[model samples]
Target: MVHVGRPRERVGITRRSLFGGVAGVGATALLAACGTSTAPSAPSAGSRSADAGGGPSRVVALSTGHLDHCLALGIVPVGLAVAVSEATDSRGIPDYIKQAFGDRYDLDSIQVVGQRMSPDLEKVAGLKPDLILSNKRADKGLTEKLTGIARTVQTNGGSEQFKADLKIVAEAFGKAADGERLLADYEGRARAWGARRGTPGTFSLVRGKGDQYLYFGTRALASIVGTDAGLTRPAAQQFDEAASRTLSLEQVGLLDADWVFYSFPGNSGDFTEAPLWKKLPAVAEGRAFRVDVDPWFLNASTVAADRVLADMQRFMST
Candidate 1:
């Protein structure tokens, strides 16, 4: 059996990357946007089971979140999209993904089919995956092409649906019980964090650099997970439908909140020095906490979700 090898050994930034940090993940590049599209075309349906002489179920996962779900379920996919970003190292697996589920398994053995946004179709098809899993929604156009290659399943966004997606993947492998248990563990951690956190307070998750600032709302991982840990959302980010909001750096006042978790992405080394960035009450009050973009802004698995809670827990302590 192919297993994760030493190439994935824990280390500092392994290579310079062209991609932005997790928070800087281009939706058009990584996981699809959270809200559903009104007109999503249906994908062909089918699943392969390992019967008698048949080989084991071969799964190919696209996007970091889906890959997390599959790996956390203890099912190393035959092929997975590579993660390449300033937030992580060059290894197909990022440090945060490893931190979240490293104790459970090695990540090196998983085959790197290609980059996240547009994987090498030839390599993916060559794997002959019995099940092709992707959790992106914004680019459902790829659904037809993926389905043509193999049975494909995609999940919706929002924290609850993210957990549900993990269960769906588990069920696909007849490991429903395993999936539910993992979700339960995640909830337990969230609840424990909520109990110890100072008190319920408003917070905003900010991501961006230069002129393109954005806020993740109730549907994004950090916002949803922060709420799970007893934090409330700022009025501007509490919208019901969309998961995120884009704003010009000039409109920084809209980010008002008791506290804020911010990621500077590729520019963490040089936090924006704009006047608007300096004016936020949260920033002036010592309530602004800089966060790692990988786990805090990317990877939507139960493991990553728990890491979010942990980040809040650490933030509260400091």
Candidate 2:
């Protein structure tokens, strides 16, 4: 058996420690836009899987989210594509994936195909994959190129449609039963966690973006999880038209709520120097907590969703 190693430990930033003597604050990156696309073409007719006989054994995932979906469905891609903007140090794989699957799979053996948006086709082709997966809808040319290499499948990109996206992947690999079971299990966990809380107050979602702040809407991943747990959102964050809205320093009051779940990229630095940031009720009362960026803002896999739920349970109970 190929030995798997434990994931490297990551420290969650707290407002008090990371922001000096001032009030605490948490942050997150700008929201990624999900483009529109028609449903992906299904696998060959009469075939239950990506291949003719069984299912795809050799797969290539073109994004961290898709990679997580494959792993969640018991499919490990031989190749993976990551974006240059990925915050994890473990090549392009997110830290949450490492923590969740590190003990079960030899992640290091998986080859890096190329950047998430534009993979190195040569490397992908070399993998000899039976199937490829992606969620990007804006680039038809890239999809065409990948399809030429293997049986490529894609989802309508967005965090809000994460469950639907997972269904698409499961269908592509002939694991619809497993996919539905996974969703049911996840929803059960989220609902159970919420039931235990018994009215956890309005939770604010914030992230640091450059010099400003991002207030997440109902459509964001964390927000979705929060909804699953019966958590309330501040009035300003109730809109679902967009994933997030940019907030200048002067508008920091919009982030105030009963609690705050926030994250920022490692390079984005701390955003605690502003007076308005210090004035937020959650910050002053020490309700704001830093979270991992990969699961909070980037990947939308089931592992990421589980991590978000786990983080909520950990921080809210404190």
The numbered model that scores best in TM-score is 2
* lDDT per residue (tens digit) for residues 56-149 in model 1: 3777888777776665554557778865666666666767666544543456656787876677778878887778887656366667778888
Tell me model 2's lDDT, rounded to 2 decimals: 0.69
Backbone-clash count (model 2): 7
Which window of 10 residues has the lowest lDDT sum in candidate 2?
29-38
What is the per-residue lDDT of model 2 for residues 1-318, given as tens digits with 9 covering 90 to 100?
222221122222121111121112121210000012121221222211243448887788888888877766656677888865536775787666765666555678678878888899999888787888876663889888888999988887778888899999988988786677777766776787677677768988887765566888998888888888889899999999898899776787888898987776654445665777778888888888888777787767666776787677667777
After superposing all C-alphas onto the true structure, candidate 2 shows an RMSD in angstroms of: 10.4
Output the lDDT of residue 62, model 1.
82
TM-score for each candidate, following the candidate numbering:
0.75, 0.81
Model 2, runs deviating above 4 Å: 1-53, 136-138
**Model 1 lowest lDDT segment of ten:** 11-20
What local distance difference test score does each model get?
0.64, 0.69
